[model samples]
Target: MLRNIPPLLSPDLLYSLRAMGHGDEIVIADANFPGSSIGPTCIRADGSTASEVLQAVLTVMPLDSFVPDPALTMQVVGDAEAIPEAVTDFQRIIDQVADNPARVQSLERFAFYERAADAFTIVQTGERRLYGNIILKKGVIV
Candidate 1:
């Protein structure tokens, strides 16, 4: 019902994004991510892929400018240097939507989970690809 909001963003998701302040993080998790069990507030975007969800979120939220890597992705297990297709798509979205040059950083499996646990909220998406989870830190508008 909102004028410029992405239709994919539900009321709860939109409210969460608006409530978050600078430096707060939100996780756009894949279908396999244990978002509910990790303990932070979890929102469901089960009809969209992680990439789709990421694109929509970046349209309304600004990425942290104070940090070197405000975006973090889960590293592929057993292959720390490998970048999955989902991660590639994430980077592409950031490049397209972010106001500044930003790149996605890889975090080890457990490290990524821990970070997600600490996030202000987690948006669990329907993406079926492995290593599709990404964490985005909020930044000031100015």
Candidate 2:
């Protein structure tokens, strides 16, 4: 294992994150996502949950502060006002990494897919909870 690096980040993942340019997006999706078909490049952390993957990714990936919404979560179906418990938990983790910069933006399911299409890669995690999906935009180190 590498020192100071989160163990959840595999060698391939690290390479992809480093290779991605500013504004490039990365999807940390739940097990239910059809990543194999949707994601251009897919990383499988089959046994670990989405929260676990999110934590690892945040350790290395910098969130784009240039945009109003660097973090995007899936909106509740039918009821846009409803915030599921799973999303709440993920929000807490994201807030910690974001340094409380701005609130996460919720996107319609179809829009979320369109946005994720621009991601450099997608990490399909083992989180089976509904709405356990999030997309993050990469930012410059400076």
Against the unseen true structure, what C-alpha lDDT does each candidate score? 0.94, 0.84
The stretch of ten residues in a row with the least summed lDDT in candidate 2 is 95-104
- True-vs-predicted CA distance for residue 68, candidate 2, Å: 0.7
TM-score of each: 0.98, 0.94
What is the C-alpha local distance difference test score of candidate 2? 0.84
Q: What would the C-alpha RMSD of candidate 1 be, to one decimal place?
A: 0.7
Where does candidate 1 have its weakest 10-residue lDDT segment? 97-106
Top candidate (TM-score):
1
Please report how far candidate 2 places residue 40 from its true position, in Å: 1.5
Q: Which pairs of residues collide in model 1?
A: none
**What are the per-residue Cα lDDT tens digits for candidate 1 across 1-142?**
9888889999999999999999999999999999899989999999999999998899899999999989999988899999999999999999998775498998999999999999999999999999999999999997
Clash numbers, per candidate? 0, 0
Per-residue error (Å), model 2, residue 119: 1.3
